[model samples]
Target: MNIRVNGEKIELSSTVKVIEDLLVFFELQERLVIVEQNREIVTKEEYQSTKLGDGDEIELVHFVGGG
Candidate 1:
């Protein structure tokens, strides 16, 4: 499937069907991060149920801290 990530076109396996699936795909499900899909904020609770379509936009932001 083809989707846009941060405005960049990328191809991923069909197995990725929902927003939360990305967590498993990228091995970040356990990591703390924020995800916005098509400009809408996606909560962790909704990630698994949020279905993704072609041409959809997905933005992932991970939290980082430095001293």
Candidate 2:
């Protein structure tokens, strides 16, 4: 399936069905990240149940520590 991530187009494997899976796909399961799907904020609890669809607009923001 193809979806837009932060304005970039990308294809996701068939195995990615939910938000949690998407995180793992991008190897971000262990990082501090925030996800917004289709203009709505997806809660941590919803990651497992929130299904993804084609053409869905997604925004992924991960915290980076420096300074």
Candidate 3:
């Protein structure tokens, strides 16, 4: 499936069906990340259950620590 992530278009394997899977695919599952799908903010608890589809727009923001 094709989805736009952070303004970039990305093609994901069929195995990636939910937000959790997408995060794992990108190796960001363990990071402090916020996900927005199709203009709506998705809570952490909804990641596992939030389904993704073709042409969906997703914005992922992850915090970086530096000092």
lDDT scores for all predictions? Answer: 0.88, 0.95, 0.98
In model 3, what lDDT does residue 20 have?
Answer: 99
For candidate 1, write residues 1-67 as lDDT tens digits. 8999878898889999998887788787887989999999999889989999998899988876789
Off by over 4 Å in 3: none
Please state the error at residue 24 of candidate 2 in Å. Answer: 0.5
User: Which digits, one per residue and each the tens of the lDDT, describe model 2 over residues 1-67?
Assistant: 9999999999999999999999999999889889999999998889999999999999999998999
What's the alpha carbon RMSD for model 1?
1.3
Q: Name the best candidate (by TM-score).
A: 3
Which consecutive 10 residues in model 2 have the weakest lDDT in total? 25-34
Worst 10 residues of 3 by lDDT: 25-34
- Please give the ranking of all candidate structures by TM-score, highest first, separated by commas: 3, 2, 1
State residue 67's C-alpha deviation in candidate 2, in Å.
Answer: 1.8
Give the Å error, residue 19, model 2: 0.5
Candidates ranked by lDDT: 3, 2, 1
